[model samples]
Target: MSTLAPPVRRTLALTKANARLLVRNRTTFLYALVMPLVPMVIVFASGGASDAAGANAVTSVLLMAVLFPVFYNVLSQVVTRRDELVLKRLRTGEVTDREIALSIALPGVAIALAVAVVTVPVSLVAGLPLPSNPAVYLLGALVSSVVFAALAFWTAAWTRNAEAGQMTSVPVMVLAVAGTLVAAVPDRVAQVLEATPGGAMYELVRTGWYGAGGVGDAVEPLVVLAAWGVVAVSLARRSMRWEPRV
Candidate 1:
């Protein structure tokens, strides 16, 4: 008679199993843990504690943390499990569909959260200024993780296999990175890009973490991110496949 709800217990069990599998995959595990730290190298090399540098560093860290661990890893796991018939088998069990999907997603989401937590201390050690709005920064990270995870499921809907993920993942990856470069683009184009998922992420960092503007300034980006998350989740629910694409 466990005190935990049945769903929680089942989801936890599934998550533990999935986490073990992820750990056994040395390549992906290493990528999820190490790749996000790569941006720290750039921050160090630049040798500047300027506001712009700090903002860029924070943005890059958040982006990398979510992109690989939360987004790509989830995409890969979903595709692999579906192809292996693991998802299909799970569906025949006591676990619900949402539980199965969440279990697959939880491991990556945990890793992303760990990285986000480590980032603050690392930033201080690197001589970057503390985020003026730590609450917003953390909220942004949470939103980013959920948004990317949903996007991964949507992407996995069409992904044939883990190998095909490499090609299929490019568009979303590009969209994410493109947002961080909005400052370099023309104003008109930047406006459009700002509405994109990546663009919204950058905006959150700009107004929330960097404190470039007031709380009101953070509203638009938050709304943009929320919209993306809703859309991605809806699409995933509709299109996600339990069986491998033949």
Candidate 2:
């Protein structure tokens, strides 16, 4: 019988409003939820051929899929709020900038987590096995979510409008997917991919799920992920705008 703290409550309110706005935009909602999953659905519909890659590959792809909705949805929140003058009013409140950023990200994180949960059982039935190391899988997913959300906030600062924001996010989404696409290549190429932002995490989660080991195994990817985290947060803090874009 405990109530949510003020910050958490505020975050929830922001998320709820953002969701309502999304639902009202039918086309955007459709694209938000559907586009990223096209690859997954196509693979699964083909009788889970690529799905045989193991739990790590399946979960990695699914986590990457969450990026489509989370980044765009959160970026759209910042852009739309600026247009509505809601962001301007928020600046006058006692709310901290970090809190504001978290509130904006709150909805997308929830959605991603829900998708992670829902996708697990469905993935198994589709031929991808359950993750052998669930903790590592969940940790990688969690880290990926925060990294993307922070990156979205960082981008939203430069965005002049919703269209501009959408366009800007395209590169990031491309980078993330391209980074993970290393799985389709040879081991040497994949080793290179393991150093890129999402690539390392993909390999990390995959190996961890499949129970691989070595001293440097966790070090490289963890370093890369942490570096991205620092970069994303610093950019957001340095550039976030509270006033209207105009």
Candidate 3:
């Protein structure tokens, strides 16, 4: 018998199968692979001369990576599989709900991480300063990926179909983008935005990559992200659909 835990084995198998399907859908795969890198144009355009500019560029790239590859992709895949009865059938088997969802989400998560890894070298090559605290930067990337993945699953619950994902995904995207614009917003609004996922992520990138503040400054954003993750997971568990919405 395989020594690996049953959940791990099942999740790995499902992830492999899903990854194959993702690759076969050349359009989605291409978007996942390519879209995250588009914001690097910011780095090059600004000449990456200042620490603040480097942090902004990296934040933009990471946010785009999580938004499209992790959040949107997972939302589309989950909705499509549910509509197709794939998730329904899988639920009838030995796989647990958590395993199934994790499996479905893993590929996109991997893509987001790959983009993060590439960002380091790309930042270096672009004349950007090194991260002041690599640990905080890494934690931010990992937590952001999880938070967005959970949000995607929650969003998938209401999505009518894969086609509807584009429309359904807009609110979160807007929130994420708005978080990045804190500098442009009023102080009261910026405070509220800072508590949002995008705002927290932007703060993390700034603190982590540019030494904007010490690790102490990461506490609030980390807490905000943790709260969002908890809420999103709870909602997804309560509302996630197995069969089509009908």
Candidate 4:
């Protein structure tokens, strides 16, 4: 019989356990599955427009598909785990902190990836054009996931518990949801939102989908995302708690 490496086995077990927990948790279920699906189905049923605007609309919906779960669901799980002493116990085991964090993040990441994959065909069927630059869109999606996951961890440091997670998560969620719709607002508002972390992600994916801008267009958003990542990582490293607060 073949034997798996110790690290691999541990990661698999942790991921599997977390995945099951996510599935069983109704809140995670709604965010990961039900919430994303509602918008997707709405977009699909609307039979997307046949223009650049239509394509942008599709892009926004797809971004939401990735954002909600990765942002909210992961935030809840991380804060809940920490408050319940799950992360503390895991830290005492052979598992590294990195492994534990990744395990906690795995379920939401899987859901985001699945939703993103389903978006392509759904957009096509809804009459949106295929991404003119697939690589750029894919890269944007990846960067967004990583940035949001880092932010989730950073936010969880102060979240206290799963119930408080909803309150703490509001600022970022509003930023993301508003960022996706900023174009519909006035130029001044759009410009302001564009400087936000979610705005950077929304612009990156939208620009990538339309292939409207040159390399210069991609550079700014990439820099914005990187900046957020750095800040979130630094803060999370400094303040994230493994033990429940008294």
Per-candidate TM-scores read 0.95, 0.84, 0.96, 0.89
Superposition error at 59 for model 4 (Å): 4.0
Candidate 1 Cα deviation (angstroms), residue 43:
2.7
User: Candidate 1 regions off by >4 Å?
Assistant: 46-49
| Candidate rank order under lDDT | 3, 1, 4, 2
Report how far residue 106 has shifted in candidate 4, in Å: 2.0
Q: Over all chains combined, what TM-score does candidate 4 have?
A: 0.89
Runs of candidate 3 with Cα error greater than 4 angstroms are none
lDDT of 4 at 194: 80
| Clashing residue pairs, backbone N/CA/C < 3 A, model 1 | none
Candidate 1 global lDDT? 0.85
- The true-versus-predicted C-alpha distance at residue 228 of model 3, in Å, is 0.7
- The residue ranges of model 2 lying beyond 4 angstroms of the native Cα positions read 1-3, 42-60, 186-188, 214-219
lDDT of the candidates, in the order given = 0.85, 0.68, 0.88, 0.75
For residues 16-101, what per-residue lDDT tens digits would candidate 3 score against the true structure? Answer: 99999888998888878889999988877655466656666788898999998899889989999999899989989999998999
- Decide which is better by lDDT, 1 or 4: 1
Tens-digit lDDT track of model 4 for 1-246:
549988878888998998888889886777778776666665565465534455446556655655666777778888888878889999898999888878877777777767766777887787666777777777777777777888888889888788888799888777677776656778898888887776786677666766667545888888887888898778888988888877
Q: How close is candidate 1 to the true structure, as a TM-score?
A: 0.95
Candidate 3: C-alpha lDDT: 0.88
Query: What RMSD does each model have against the real structure?
Result: 1.4, 3.0, 1.2, 2.3
* Tens-place lDDT digits, model 2, residues 66-185: 576677777888877877788888778876676777777766676666666666676666666566666666666667778888888888888898888758887777767666666678
Candidate 4, lDDT over the whole model: 0.75
The most accurate candidate by lDDT is 3
